[model samples]
Target chain A: MWQLYQFPLCPFSRKVRLLLGEKGIGYEPVRESPWLRRDEFLDLNPTGQVPVMVDTDRGVALIDSTVICEFFEETVDKAAMLNGTAVDRAEIRRLVVWFDSNFFRDITAPLLEERMIKRLVHRTAPDARALRDAMKAAVGHLDYIDYLLDHRTWLAGPTMSLADLAAAAQISIADYLGGIDWKSHEQAKRWYVGMKSRPSFRPLLSERMDGIPPPSDYDKLDD
Target chain B: MWQLYQFPLCPFSRKVRLLLGEKGIGYEPVRESPWLRRDEFLDLNPTGQVPVMVDTDRGVALIDSTVICEFFEETVDKAAMLNGTAVDRAEIRRLVVWFDSNFFRDITAPLLEERMIKRLVHRTAPDARALRDAMKAAVGHLDYIDYLLDHRTWLAGPTMSLADLAAAAQISIADYLGGIDWKSHEQAKRWYVGMKSRPSFRPLLSERMDGIPPPSDYDKLDD
Candidate 1:
């Protein structure tokens, strides 16, 4: 049996969930609020972060979404989600880091801190300066995504891989916050539409929090 | 032949260099200042991040230090830097992410922004507030590392792995700025002394930047 601790809105958590679903793996999910630093959760993961997976069969707990996902790939050795040769896997990993680190820093993180975190923490209002900077950076990132889509069927190559999942996860969060101007980048929007239609992506598309609701078209498969 | 574009003080860049050195792989090193954002450099890596490696034999350019290091492990398959079983590899990767993402964000980054970046950009004095916050966070991080070192021969296991390289690279940067109080963490210091004595660590220890000189004890293997 496998179990995972996750927060509904964290892109890293969403990426792992999608990977498991795509591989047709079954696991129990436990929602975690890392900021609260719950004792039991901290016992499982000293990092106090989400997407920690407990693989009962292996009798080991895995921390870090990337580590957990890659562990599944190595041990299970099925589903070939990382797909292809050494160079192909390298390309996929590069794109994963690009979305997880680069995009999150310049766009998703600041926006989340202002919009979601402020609301959750009962802080007054979102910081205008942070919002402006993130939105400006988003334009460039969105354009880059569009450019990548123009050349390849997926972000890294022909087949959909972790790169696509990582990118879409962040974009999904941004879309829920009404931060993406999809109409401005048709290619990127089209690629996302394809991702939305995947059965593995279904649960994430319909996710909702207590005081937050996604946009009306948030779960739609097509424009 | 492999050629790596890197910056001397970048932790991500250093991580890759250490991995290559430990693997005993030969490569031409190109020093890059990512802040300058050179056109040719940006052409090779759209993100313009340092530590991009081009394998002319493979005819592919790899971006992201972690990705590059992992690629070498996959292709070279000689060095057992990530040696051990699947679960063991997972533990090492977890620690790598712990250092690269978590530690970088909370401590190394803010301190670099205040101390190193300020000097590089020819800006005014370091921000006292940012420096204080980073220092406070550094203590907690150092304690965690110390606790880990108390239990293990090396982080994640009995062997030196990418986890150690990733961590030592970050700490080396902090140590350069005189951020570490080695006296406070005896076990961590002892482990570091062993790492500093390794031949793989030699080049990094001797590195000197234009206006920045390491503290007197920075390069000393047996202090």
Candidate 2:
């Protein structure tokens, strides 16, 4: 079995977990707190980021969330997330980058820094300005998601893709940190509700980081 | 032909250019300064980033450098920068992400912000401390590259891959900004020299970003 080194609150790990769950790929979850920068974890992945998949018996360890997802997408044929032609796949990959890089940068990263990291690691009070900034960014992000959904059935296109999983992964973490406000984002909220109802997303929603409590409706399918 | 939207100093654009050049693909260069965030450019790519590949006839635009790279790798098979088995490809991708994200963040981005943007747009002098810090980080990055070169013929493995292109692209930009010091990193320097000498790298070295000049030895292959 592949040992997935991840923490519950890591958006990247959550993205990979969703992919693994959707593909029916079995892996034992090995909790990795990347912020702690464990030496052993550094040996496995020099970058020291999580969502690493290690098959110890086979001596193969895949690092990076996208790398792990692409590896499985190549090896397994079931429930293809990176579906369709070159052009279509480009669209899917583009959105994946958008969420992973832009959304995470604007919303999730700030929330994690203010609401989670500062609280957990530094034992400091969350910065109100930073939290407010993240929430404001969340509104813009959800607007973009609503814009995307206006045309396509799913996030990327007609079919559900890794793009959806990536977006939800970041959004879930941001929501957990109380950065997201569902008001006037009905379209994005509806799509997210559909994503939350997925079996892959259930386990992630149920798992909580110590000393960090999500909003009351974070795990709810109908909020 | 794909029209590549990019600016000379953008490392991401350089990475995609290297890939297209290696793959023997031709693209018309359309200069796009993403920092400008022009409305039309935003229409082409909502993120307002460069290294976007657009096929006007097909009405297809591949946004994000990695997305553009993957699309070309899928469409073109001549050079195969992402060559090798699934596991090997994972390694290649992980390294690509390393250079694209980490290296760029630590070295290239700061250098560009300080040396280029500060000079061009902000009309402010580069911070001596930030320049010192980026140059310092460049040394550590070069050390890591030296370590990688110790094990493999290329950054990823025995075969040259997109990982090499990614590294070279970022290093080239950093080198242009005079951030990199090739001292005590013989292995990395040797590898980088080889990359710089390539036909693909030739055009990039020749192309100048307005108002910001590279170091005297920037384009020298045998410096």
Candidate 3:
């Protein structure tokens, strides 16, 4: 039996969930609120971050979504998310880092913090200046994604990959906050529409957060 | 021949440089100013980030330091930086992510921005508020490093791994900026001293930036 501790709306957690689904791995999901800093959660992961996977059968615990995903890639080759030659794998990993780090830093972090976490955590209303900056940053990223999709069927290559999952996961959070302007980037929108129709992404699309409802077209399969 | 485009003071770049040295692979160094967003450099990496690796022999280019390091781990086996079983590798990777993301976000980024990048980029004087927060965050990280060192010979296990390289790369930048209070955390200092003494780390210690001089003890092997 495997158990995954995760937050419902965390992009990192969503990335892991999507990967697990794609791999056809079944695990019990445990929702964790890292902001609470619960002792037990901290005990499991000193960092107090979610998306911690406990492989009960293996008698091991893994933290960091990317690391956990890589572990799966290494151990289970049945449904490989990182399939390819060394260069191809590097391409996938590069985009994974880009979405998880650069994209998250520039777009997801500020928008999510302002739109969601602030309200949940009793912080003051979202900062307008921060939102403006995030909005500007997001356009560039969306345009880049459009450019990439123009050349390749998927983000990194022709096949589905962790890169697609990662980008979708991060962008999904921004989408839930109504940050993504899908119409502006048709190619990227088409790529995302393809991702949205996949069975692996179904669960994430159906997730609902109280007090912050997603836009009507948020979960739609078509742009 | 391999050529690595890097910035001398970038933590991610240093991480790659350290991993390459540890792996016993030689590559020509190409200094890149990512901030300049040179057309040629941006052509290789749309992100305009430093630490892009070009393998002339293989006719491939790779970006993202972690991605590059992972590529080396996959393709080269000379000095295994990811040495261990699956579980062990997960632990090492978790720490690498911790240092690269959490540690960098909390401590190293602010300190470097204030103490070093400000002068290099001609930004305004360091923001006092940011520096204060970074100082407080540094203490928590230093304590964590001390705790980890107390239990293990090396940061993920008895053998040196990318975990140490990543942590050291980030910390070395902090040290260069004179942000590390070595006297406050003896065990971490001792561990860092071990890392610094390695032949792999020699090149980084000798690297000199134009205006920002490292502390006198920056390159010292022994305390």
Strongest candidate by lDDT: 2
What RMSD, rounded to one decimal, does every model reach? 1.9, 1.1, 2.1
lDDT of 3: 0.88
Q: Pick the candidate with the highest DockQ.
A: 2
* DockQ metric for all predictions: 0.79, 0.93, 0.76
Instruction: For candidate 3, write residues A77-107 as lDDT tens digits.
Output: 7668897898999999999989998889988
Model 1 per-residue lDDT tens digits across residues A1-223: 8888887788888899888988888989887889899999898888898889897776889899889888888876556678899899999999999999889888888878888899998666998998888878888888999888888999999898999999998888877876777769888988989989999999888778778887898998876
Q: Tens digits of per-residue lDDT for model 2 on B134-153?
A: 99999988999999999999
- Candidate 1 residue runs with Cα over 4 Å from true position: A56-59, B56-58
| Local lDDT at A150 for model 1 | 84
lDDT for model 2: 0.92
Better of 1 and 3 by lDDT: 3
Cα deviation of B107, candidate 2, in Å: 0.6
* lDDT per residue (tens digit) for residues B158-182 in model 3: 9989999999999999888777777
What is chain B's TM-score across the candidates, in the order shown? 0.95, 0.98, 0.95
Give the residue spans of candidate 2 off by over 4 A.
none
TM-score, chain B, predicted structure 1: 0.95
TM-score of each model, paired residue for residue: 0.95, 0.98, 0.94
Clashing pairs in 3: none
**Between the candidate structures 2 and 3, which one is better when assessed by lDDT?**
2
Candidate numbers sorted by DockQ from highest down: 2, 1, 3
